[model samples]
Target: MARIASEALIERLAEWGVDTVFGLPGDGINGIMEGLRRHRDRVRFVLVHHEEAAAFMAAGYAKATGRIGVCLATSGPGGIHLLNGLYDAKLDHVPVLAITGMQETSVLGTGYQQEVHLDRLFADVAEYNMMITNPAQLPSLVDLAIRTAYARRGVAHLTLPNDLQVAAADADPYEHVAPARPPQTAPVYLQPPGIPRQEDIEWAADVLNKAERPAILVGQGALHARQEVLAVAETLGAPVVKTLPGKAVLPDDSPYTTGGIGLLGTRPSEELMEETDVLFMVGTNFPYSKFLPEPGKARVVQFEADPVRAGARIATDVPVVCDAKEGLAALLPLLTPRDDSAHLAKYQKMMAKWRSDMRSLENPDRDPIAPQYAISVVDDLATDDAILTCDSGTIATWAARHWTIRGAREFYLSGTLASMANGLPYAIAMQHAYPDRQVIAYVGDGGFAMLMAEFLTAVQHRLPIKVIVNNNNSLGQILWEQMVLGYPEHGVRFAAPEADFSAWARSCGGFGAKVSKAVDVAPAVREALQHDGPALVDVDVNPNEPPMPGKVSYDQAKSFAQAFLKGQPHRAAIASTLFKDRIQRLGD
Candidate 1:
C-alpha cells in the first residue's frame, strides 16, 4: 500500500478534473510541489507572485469555463493572502477550491512556526471549510470540496496538516467518486395562478391590436430566452431596447434592435423609449428609476421570472410572473398584431438624429481628445471575439457605452459592487483560462496603480494580455460631478509626478509604449497587439477635458455653476469651460 501523502493528493486532483492549479510555493507545501513536478504532463501549476492573484486567476477560469478553479498555498501568510480573491469569487458567484498546507498535527495548539487557524481565517470567504488531520480522510474531503464548490457556486477551503499528508494508508481503500452531475429540474412555465387574467389578456390584446407604436425592452434575463424574445418582438412588429447588462440578449444587427438606455446609453434606445406609448419589459431589473419614464404616459407591461422583481421599481399595468422566455411564449400567442410602421418610423428618425448629435463629439477636430472617441477607436481595433474587462470608475462608463461585443465575445465589469482595481486581475484570469482569445483591460491611471503588482503574474505565466491605461491625472468622474453638482473638488486629484508606465513595463520584462498625441494611439495599439507576451499602452490624456455632450439635471447644473463660481484658482479655467455651453431650459 502506498502512503496517502502529497504525491497521492496531486494524483487525486488530476483524476477529479483539475488540469491547472495557481499558487506560490512555500516550505509547508514542498511535498505538494514535488507531487506537481511528477505530474507535469497531466497537470500544470501556475506560479503567481501573490496568492491573491492566484485566487483571482482561478475565479476568472471558473467564470469563463463554468469549471471549478483550484489554487494551493502554504500555511500562515500564504494562506491568508488568498482571502481577497476568495471573497471576490464568492461575491461574483464563481466556483473555486483552495487547498492550503498547515503545520504538523502534533503541534496543533502549541504556537508552532508558521501556524495559524486557517479554517477560521477562511470562514468568511468559503462556503465550506474543513481541516484534514488524518490521511484516511483526504480522498473524501477532496471529493466533498469539489462537490460543494459546484453546488454552491462559491469558494471552498481545505487545510492539510504536514504530518497527515505523508501518513501511510490502505491502498485503494477509498473509492474514486464520480463528479456530481447537475439535476434535471422541471422547466419553469411563465404563467401563474390569478395573473394574466382573461379580461386583462383581452384588454392587452386590444391595445396590441390597435397600437401603431410598440417597443420591447430586453434585460439580462432575456439572454437565456433569446429565441423567444426575438419571436415576440418579430410578432408584435416592435423594436428592441436593451439594458446595459442585457447587451448580448439580442444581436446588434437585428433589425428590431436598438441599443442600451441610461447615462452610458446610446441614442436609438433612449429615443424609442421616449416616443413609444406601449413598452414591454422582458427579463430586466434596471435599477435606475429615473430612466423608466412616467407610468401614466407610457403603457408599461413586464414579464419576469421572480415575482418580487416584477413591479418593484416602476408600476406595471400588465405584469406576468414567469420565466422571460415562457412569459413571452404565452403572451405572443394571446396578443393581436397591429401595424407599427408609423411608430417605428418616428422613433427611427429620432435615433438617426440622436446618433448624429453624438457623432459631433467624436470629430477629429475636437481638442484634448474626446474620451468617447478614444473608446470608439479602441473598439474598432479590438478583435470581434475579444474579452473586455473594465475597472470601476469613469473608464467603466466609457467602455460600457462604446465597447461593442458579438455573441462570441464577453464583457465583464464590477457592476453590482462597483469595486476598483479589478481590471488587471480580471485580465490575468481571462488570459489564463482562454489563451487563444484576445483579452483587453480598459483601466484608469488611479485604478491601474492600485493593483499594478499583479502585472508580474502576467509576465511569469507569459499570458498575453493588453492593458490600456486612460491616464487622466485626476479622478475624471468625480471631477466632472463636482463641476456639475454643488460641490467643490477636494482630494480628487493625484499630485505625484507622472511615472513613465511604458518604461516600467519594459523594466518588468513586458512590451510597453507611451502615447500622448491622438495620432499615436492606433500605432501603439497595433504594436502592443503584435507583442508575443503581456503588453501595456500608457496613454496620457487631457485631465481638464470633460466627457462630451454632458447629460445632467437643471438643479444639478445650477449647483455646479454655484460651486464653480466659489472654486479654487487652479481649476478656474476648467470650471469656466464646463459652464460656457450650458443651456438654461430643462426640456430636450
Candidate 2:
C-alpha cells in the first residue's frame, strides 16, 4: 500500500461508503486514475464516454438511492462539463459530490493548458467548494465536502491538483471524518436536521381542520412523507395534487391523488385547485404560481424541510419549517377529521373521468402507434419494484400521465433543470447503484440519441437496465410547443437519417427489440426486462401527437389556431386528439 495522497483520498472515499464513481479518463486526472487502479476492488471506476453523462449518472444515483453521488472529471473543460448535471442535483436538492483533477501545483495561474478557475467556476453550484492545495488539507477537506453535500442536499466540489494527488501523504493527524463502514440503517437520511415546533404543527393542523375545502399540493421534497400526506388528505378530505417532480410521491391511481396540476397535469387537479378554500402545500416549491391558489382567496400553509425555500413562491400564511414527515406526524394528531367530504368526492369523480379519458387516449387505434399507447403498454409491463427515469420531453408527459407507481415503484425526474439526454445516464446510475432492482429509462428518440452511447456502458457493466425509447424521429415536445406559440417548428421538424437503434444495441452485446405495432409494446418491454444485460426497446410512435395542457388559455388557443391556419404538418391528427381531450375537459 503506497502512502500516496490519491490513495488516502480514495481510501477516505471508500470509508464514506462510496463503492462506485462514474467518470472518464484524461491526462489531468492520471493520478486519480492511478489511485482508482490501486483501489480497484473497493472502489470501482465506471468509465463513461462523456464527462456530462458521468455527472448526470451521479445525480441520478443520489436521487434514486438517497445517498451522496460521486462523479470525477479533469480540470478545465472536464470540470465545466459537470455543471449541467450538478445544477440538476442542486435544483432538485439531491446530494452529489464532484471531484475534478487540476493542473500541477507548480502552475498557480499562468493560463496553463486546459487551465480554468475551477473553484470560482463551481462556486455557485456547490454548497461546499475547495481546492486541495496540500496533502494535509486533503483528509478534512474531502470529509467536509462529502458532509456538506449530504447535509445541504446539494452539490459539493473538490479539485485535486495532479502533483498533490500522487505526492506522499501527510501524517495521520486527525481521526477519519467518515464512518469505518456504511450505516446499517434501513432507510438513511444523511443529516436529518430539524423537527417542527409543537405550536407550529398545531397551528398548521388547526388551519386545515377549520377550512371547508382544503387542497393538498405535494412535491419531490415530500417524497418520504406519503403516509403523512395521505393522513392529512384523509383528515381534511382534501384532494392531493402532485407537482411534476412529485409524480411518484403518491400513486396516480389513488383516489386522493388528483394527478399533476399544471401544463403536464390533469384538469381535475386544476379545477379542484381553484375551488379549494385552503391550500396545504407540503414539501414543494411548485414553480407555476399561476396554478396555485390566489393570494387572497385561499389560505396557504406550506411545510418544508429547507427554511430558505419557505414562502419562496406563493405567499405562505403559515410557514412550517421542518421535515415533511416529522411535521405531518406532529400535525396529524392535532387535526380532527372533516365531516364534509364534498370536495374530496368531487375531485375523485373528476379523477375517475380523467382516468377514463386518459385510457381512451392510450388505447387510441392510431396507425403510426400512439405514443400514449406504447407508454401505457410499457407502464403495464413495468414490475412493481421497478425504478423509472423519464427524459425531459413528451416522454416525461407520458410518464407523468400514464405510469402506475405502485408498491416500491419510483420515478427519477430531471426536475427544475428539465435537461435532455438525462434518462440513459440516470438509469445506468440507478442500475449500478441497485443491481438487483429493475431500472428503466423512458426516453424520447431525440434524448435517447443524445446519450445513446451510454447504453454501451450499461452493457459493459452488465447492469440489466431496460431503456424504452419513444422513436418518434422528432422532438415532439418542442414541435408541439412551437405550434402552441403560433410559430412554425422550423429547426426541430427534421428527423435524423435512418439508423437502426435496436440493432446497435445487439451489436454492443445487449438485447434489442424494435416495435412498430401497438400490440408489440407490452411484449417488447417484457422481453427487455427479462434480458440478461442492457436491453433497448425502440418503439416507433406517432410524431404528430401533442401533450394537451391541463387548461388551454385563450391566447394559447389563438396561437394554436393560427399555426393550424398556417398549415402545420399533420394538423388533422393533432386537432382530432385536441378535440377529444377538450371534449373530455368540458365533461362531455
Candidate 3:
C-alpha cells in the first residue's frame, strides 16, 4: 500500500492545477499509466492515437488556455514522436511539460529495449531537460520542471525509468541533505507582469506623436491586451495589422483593423505597411520583415515581454520591454492623440474594397467548389464564439483571408513552426477544454491526411468537433509555391484514388459528409456542425484555384507565367482561374 514515485509525480502535478494529460499508453510507461489509473479522480488521461498527436494536443491546449499543458509518451519511438510537436511549443514560446518513459536505470547504458536516452534527445527542444534516476528526486524535479516551463514559456521534459516510476516514495537518499527541501504542493501562480518605465513610455509616445502616419502590428502576444491595442490604434488613428496567430487580438470586422500580414495577409495591411511612417509593433515578433515598412523608412516602437525578443524582428527606434497589456496601457496616456483621419481612412477604404473583392471570389454557384467559397460558408455559419483551428498550406490562405475573427471567437495554428497536420489535433484539444463550445478544424487535404487517425480519438471521446477538409486532392500550397517560384509543378499532386475522409469518419462512429458542388458547401457544413458527435466534412474544392499572395510582385507573376509556358501539368485548368482572378483584382 506504499505510495509510488509515479503517484507522487501525479499528485504533485494535480496540486499545480493540471486536470488532464494527453498521451498514449505503452508497456514502457505501464507504471505511469497505473499511477494515472490510481489518481483518476485528480487527473484524466486523454488517449491519443499517436504520440505526435498527443504532443500537438498539449501544445494546442497551452496556446488556447495560457496554462501549462502536459503530455506523456513511452520510451524510444514514442518519445521520439513528440519532437515535432514539442518543437512547435518551443518555437511558439508556450509552456508545455512533456513526460516520457525510459528503460530501467540499471539497463539505461546497456542499450536495453525502448532505451533511447530521452533526456538527451529532448535537450534541444526542452528549456529544462532531465531524467529522474532516483525515486526521491521525483517531487523536486517535478516542481522544477513545471516552474521552468512556466518561467521560460517553453517546453520542459522529464524522462522516468520504468523501475523507478514504481519505486516506494519513502526511498530517499536526498531527504537527509541539509536545509531539507519539501515538494511544492501549492498551485503555481504567474509572476507579476513586467511594466515598462515612464521614461521609455514617454520616448515611445514622442516618436509616435511626431510621425505623420502610424500603423500598429500585433501578434499573439497582444491577445490578452485587446482593449489596450484598440485604445492605442484609436488614439493614433492607425490601421491595425495582425499576424496569423494574432488574428483574435482585435475584431477583423473593425474598420481600423486589417486582417493579417505577409503572404497570407490582406491588401490593406500591405498598403498600410508600405505607406506608414511609424510602425508600432505590439506583442509580436512578426517574422516576415519584407512585409514591414522598408528598414530605415519607418521608425519602429515595439512592446515585448521578453527583453531578448525586443526589437528582434524589425529595427526599433524604441523598445519597450514589459508585458504587452501593461506597456500599452502605460504608453496610452502619454501620447497626444492624432486627430487626422486621412491615414486611417485610406486603409479602411482599401479594407472595404478588399473585402468586396474577396466576396466576389466566394461564388456560391461556381461548380467544383472554390476553396475560398467553401471556407467562407463555414465562416458565415460559425458561432460568434467558436474556436477555429487551421492547418498549414493553402487552407491557411483560405482561412486567413476568409474567416473573420469577431466577437469572442478564437483562432489558432502552427504559426512560428508552420507545421502541417496540427489543425485536427488543435481542434480536438480545444473541444476537450470547452466541450460545450463550437470547435472547428479547417485543414487541407495534405495536412489532414498526415494524422487522420486522430479522428478516431475524437470519436472515442465523443468530442463534437466539426472538421472541414478542403479536399483539393493535391498539396495545393506547394504546387503554387513551385509555380510562383518558376519551377515546373512536380511531386505536388497526390496519386490517383483520393481518400474518402468522410467515409473514414463514419467508420469511426462520427458524422460524415462530402460536398462536391458549390451549392452543397453551406448545407454540408451546417449538417456537420449540427451533428451531436464528432463530424468530418470532405469538401471537394477546386484544385486549380490559386492561393494568391496579398500583393504579387512582377517577378512572381512572371515566374508563374513561366511555369505555365514550361508545360506545368494542370496549367490549362489553372490558367483560366488565374486569369479570372487577376481580372477581378485589377478592377479593384
**Of the candidates shown, which would achieve the greatest lDDT relative to the real structure?**
3
- In model 3, pairs of residues that clash are none
Worst 10 residues of 1 by lDDT: 579-588
Q: TM-scores, in order shown? A: 0.78, 0.94, 0.98
Model 2 residue 552 CA deviation (Å) reads 2.0
Each candidate's lDDT (Cα)?
0.73, 0.85, 0.89
Tens-digit lDDT string for candidate 2 (365-478): 566788888888878887888899989989888888888889888988788999999999999999888888989999988888888899988888878999889888888889
Better of 1 and 2 by lDDT: 2
Q: Rank the candidates by TM-score, best first.
A: 3, 2, 1
Off by over 4 Å in 2: 171-192, 576-588
Worst 10 residues of 3 by lDDT: 176-185
Q: Candidate 1 at 148: error in angstroms? A: 3.9
Q: For residues 1-588, what per-residue lDDT tens digits would candidate 1 score against the true structure?
A: 354467657766777778899898998787678778877898889887778777777877776677789988999999998887787677666689999989987898999898998999888888889997655565666767777887666899988887666666333334474423323342121224423445555555556555466888887667667888778777778888887557777765566677777766665676666667788888777777677666676787777656667777677777766667756666677776544466656655655555455444443433455565667677778888888888777786677657766666677765444567778877987787788999998888887887787777788778999998888877878786766666777778888787567887888899989887787787888888878999999887667655532245577668767776777444666754444323211112
Error of 1 at 153 (Å): 3.4
Give the number of the best model, judged by TM-score.
Answer: 3
- Residue-level lDDT of model 3, residues 334-429, one tens digit each, is 888888899889888898888989988887766677788899999999999999999999988998888988899999999999999999999999
- Flag regions of model 3 displaced more than 4 Å: 173-180, 183-185, 583-588
